[model samples]
Target: MKSTEYITVTQLCTQYKVTSQWFHKLHDTGLIHITTVEEQPCVSLQAIHQVDKIMRLHQELHVNAEGIDIILNLLEKIDTLQLEMNSLKSRLNIYDTEQ
Candidate 1:
């Protein structure tokens, strides 16, 4: 599929070997965002990675939906903090060089 293409739920289910009900459960639990395309539910390619992570957390780690939600939120916060740290380091370097 093209990079700009949105994948349908059926395509995701077929590729991941999961059921529609499972996908719906993930959607309902806010683990994944489902977009509507031509009245059919679809997922973006960018979200595919998140879906995979959720699957790993569910199947491999046996995490429940609530736990997964917390894990994902923490991960996102970590990412944000890392980015902020990098920006701060860059600013510090600039100030140090000017002094």
Candidate 2:
């Protein structure tokens, strides 16, 4: 598909100073999603932040792909729980006001 919101895998590799294999590893581990367009693999603009995070964790923090996967999973859980807690707190406040 013709879209302005995606960067090709080759472009991402060069821009991020990482190898194509690295991106493949990330994809294999489910850390990032890849879409193939015009027979070329690309990532969406919305996932750039996540891609950067994965790279930083691997390059700077020396985390492996598996480690990155675990870290990401934990982060997702934390965010989900935080949202649930906020929702519960709002409901509790409403009940308190009714008392």
Report the number of clashing residue pairs per model. 0, 0
> What TM-score, computed on C-alpha atoms, does each candidate reach?
0.71, 0.85
Q: Write the per-residue lDDT of candidate 1 for residues 1-99, one digit (tens) a residue.
A: 443467889987887777888888888988888888777788888888898898889888988788899999999999999999999999999999997
Specify the poorest-scoring 10-residue window by lDDT in model 1: 1-10
Q: Give the best candidate by lDDT.
A: 2
Local accuracy of candidate 2 as per-residue lDDT tens digits, 1-99: 576778899998998798999999989988889998878899999999999998889889999999999999999999999999999999999999998
Instruction: Output the lDDT of residue 28, model 2.
Output: 93
lDDT of each: 0.86, 0.91
